[model samples]
Target chain A: MIEVKNLSKTFTSHVKEPGLKGSIKSLFSRELVTKDALKPVNLNIEQGEIVGLIGANGAGKTTLIKILAGIVHPTAGEAKILGYTPWERANEYRRQMALIMGQKNQVWWDLPALDSFILLKEIYQIPDAQYKYNIEFLAEILMVKDQLKTQVRKLSLGERMKIELMAALLHNPKVIFLDEPTIGLDISAQKAVRGFLRQYQKEFKPMTILTSHYMEDIKELCPRIVIIKSGEFVYDGSLSDVQKMMGDEKVLSVTTQNGVFKVSVPRQDLAKKTHELFEEHYVLDLNIQDPSIEDVIESIMKNGIGAT
Target chain B: MKWWKDVMGMELRKILAYRSDFWITFLGQTFIQLMVARALWQAIFETQGVSEMQGFTLEMMGLYYLIAPIGMKILNGPNFGFLAQEIYDGTFTRYLLYPLSVFQYKTLTYLTYSLFYSLQMIILLGIYRLFISEVAFTSVDVGHLFLGLLLFIIGAIAYCMMGMMIEMIALWADNIWSLAVMLRFFTSFFGGALIPITFLPVWAQNILVWTPFPYLLSLPIRTIMGLSTFQEVTQGALILMLWTLIFMEGVKLVWKKGQFKYTGVGI
Candidate 1:
């Protein structure tokens, strides 16, 4: 289980001036600027639930994940994963959780991926039989069993990412924080990751919070979605609810003799509007469809979530 | 204990994997430096018409240069620049997420490096004994040798702590390469890796005697050469231990504050 309340982070940086005179002046009178990466937010994730966290760049998605991962201390509020404060970085808390930053590697570059797993095995103090069983099971599920002996640097991006997942999951963490776990991979690799993650959720039922730029990943893996805007959560509900909240209007595409005409109308008024259109013109084809989740998220991002 | 052993083993494997760098740095560079140093000392002794300089015989000076590299290698271990680079690049997040302490992990990595360098030094020494007729530690004092080994271990740890503290400044500065170079220069000059501390002016020697740099490499070399009295060895050991404690405490404070300042940007 994961719980976050009023969790926020602000970064302060020095405002340095250019040129020698400005540099000299800054020594005595430097300006400091603060940027809020996360506004106060609250959330609760139940065990085995895969929560997709979506936001544009600088939307505090990664910041929130880092705080919960205990890699970055929050500026305000508290986050508890399995009842332990993350920032305390208690060993027991660490042992029960795993954080994977897709852009960065957790495996050793020069050594075989298996070597890194063995090192993790020791670090977590896992029993030999359990460790062996977990590695074999994870590798088989991820279809990276043979590639485990290859030097990590020599593996393809997809292969390396699979090994990274294995390395993180070797101890069978109770909670997993994944930040863009499929960021740079190709399509098949992305699908493979999503498949493995979905299966992992089904089998182990660990609480997982994932942030990814890929919309399809969210659509495929996350049944529940949390949409954040400008460091605050704008929407938190089922994926379908996001589509509905984007608006009750469904797009209507009518293929007339002249051309295809698209118009948006409220779902409740769709039948009447289509009937009137049919009366006024010759309709070759008519299609009514709700907006995609991607469209809903894009709308929320462009024109604050409240407008949706 | 298993974790520590595993960490050290992992580091050793990493070091061994980079065979080219290991051979070039440990064998090539050290061999060239030793040969050049021996030639320079040979020229000075042959031309000066003096048997000894600053209480060092030509043979002793030759042996000092030979052993000084090994001593400096042990004292400095590997540069902590990688630690600084890790902080700057955000790769350190890996350690942050792990259950193990980063300090202990890094210390073990450096210890493995030092151990590997010690092995290389032993091989070099064996080669020297095989090919050359010259005897290095002719007047071996077992008690002093034991004391010197203990001091050497403490001094190596003190240097590691010092390097880590310096590298932690990378959390604030973008380029710590210049700072690291400055540290190396200061340590090599005062630690007598460049020249015997006795060759310096008496006041300079007195000033350095109170600092930790000399104890890092110079005192250990002197103790092994049977040049230090029992009282001086005891005093140096205590001072080295004190310096180790101070640097370790500084590391804790600096690392704690540095983590707060960490932006985790590079990755």
Candidate 2:
């Protein structure tokens, strides 16, 4: 449902020195500098698949999403979401897709969420019957039915987010792009959003791409993970494969007569290493397990995935 | 069509939600302006010892001040500060995500604000007419009145487009508040909303006539007051339409170029 080929975006900004002199100088001659926000990124997301986009700050995950959502045009290459060129911004493309930015708001701040919902209804040209059903279902799932009448500014962050999600989904979009949807929310609120997204994806089978700093959001909702660094994807595979990429590293715990000792070793060397240790010491209990996802991701983030 | 109507309805509700602010900005502020202009014009006519100044009788002066505020509303439309804020803060992403055009959305919003503003001015004028005894109502032909209203709508659109172009400059500049203030002062002084264009020096009036600023406020006011001949009104309307097209093209060009620089920063 989504395809991106060599999709890249470059941002150019003017550099000013300082003070009144610099300001005047800038007016006369602006020093232009270019930064690559995204570098020839490629990804293909199939229908009914939910992919987690993981990257450090300024790693181009959000840039990639914005490019696919048509908010920012690419400086080079192309991207198509559900068979429509996103940058062209065709009405059919917009109607069948939705982009939800957690830090940004789509609802009118002073008006009730229901009012914004009504506006979205017209915006997406949803049929009356379908709009009613979608709102009822989405509101009930997000547990914001009673809160829809209150002004958005008065609602809790979680409540507002629920309403935002409802607004994006009112048209029953075929593709969804979520950027930090769970950021700044309480744990329960985060859980609610993650749970809703999981169920929503299951029911609708829409291709979804989500970016969040929260590891739990990635672990719980995304079966396939795409990790990028420095404007390029370094790893793209299942959650378990990421551990394998961390290289056969397992945490080995041994409870001997001298208490317990924990050591890290490759999976291939575990048997020989453990046997040699058993011969040298009195081993009481031993356990071998792969490193946690967090440890692997941390190592990937600190050092490039290629290093792992 | 439904999308435009929806935006208009939502903007109306937003204005109603801040109805107190509406009263303060439109009624309280406009009342002060009218009183000040009335006092200034009264002193000028009294000092000159003449019943008329620049083809305006004392009653016509009173009528001009009465209508100037309404003309300002049409010429100013709603402030583009909201659009500027959106562009600066990166919330403009919301509009890009939606299927509707940002231009259409903002235009409809202005139209809604103008509708509410016109209603409020009519009510205020109704109240004023109850106490005033010698106010002149211009005897305009029906065809001319319709033509004037059409010209007024087109002129409002021109102002809106011009405002949008200025606000879109925020994508390049750090702050635009000063620019907006300067624009407001320029329009009020040279657009002939603060004083009659005929009262200005001949050279200044001649230059102002060549530009679109006067058509936005002064031409409509003069057309309604029957101060303009039918030929002048026709020519002014054509010039105003031409300016609207130019500003509309400018808006499109600025917005398209501005998007390339938009990193969706801040928000």
Top DockQ prediction, candidate number: 1
Residue A196, candidate 1: alpha-carbon lDDT = 93
Give the top-scoring candidate (lDDT).
1
Q: What DockQ score does model 2 reach against the true complex?
A: 0.64
**What proportion of the true contacts does each candidate reproduce?**
0.68, 0.66
Q: Model 1, residue A266: displacement in angstroms?
A: 4.2
What lDDT score belongs to each candidate, Candidate 1 first?
Answer: 0.85, 0.83
Q: Which CAPRI category fits model 2? A: medium
Indicate the residue-level lDDT of B132 in model 2: 66
Q: Provide C-alpha RMSD values for all models, in order.
A: 3.6, 4.2
lDDT of 2 at A275: 87
* Candidate 1 wrong stretches, greater than 4 Å: A15-31, A252-288, B140-149
lDDT of 1 by residue, A1-308 (tens): 89999999999888988999989998799899999999999999998898999999889898898888888889999788999999888999999999887898889999999899889999998999989898878988899988988889999999999999999988888999888999899999999999999888888888999999999889998999998988999888898788777478887889999999777687889899999999999999999887777767887877876666
Clashing pairs in 1: none
| Per-model TM-score of chain B | 0.92, 0.91
Expressed as tens digits, the lDDT of each residue in A1-308 for candidate 2 is 78888988888878999899999998889999988878887889998999999989989899888888887778999777888999778988999999888988888999999999899999999999999999889988999889989989999999989989999999999999999999899999999999999889988988899999999999999989998888888888899788777566787888988799777787788889988888988999989877778878877877877656
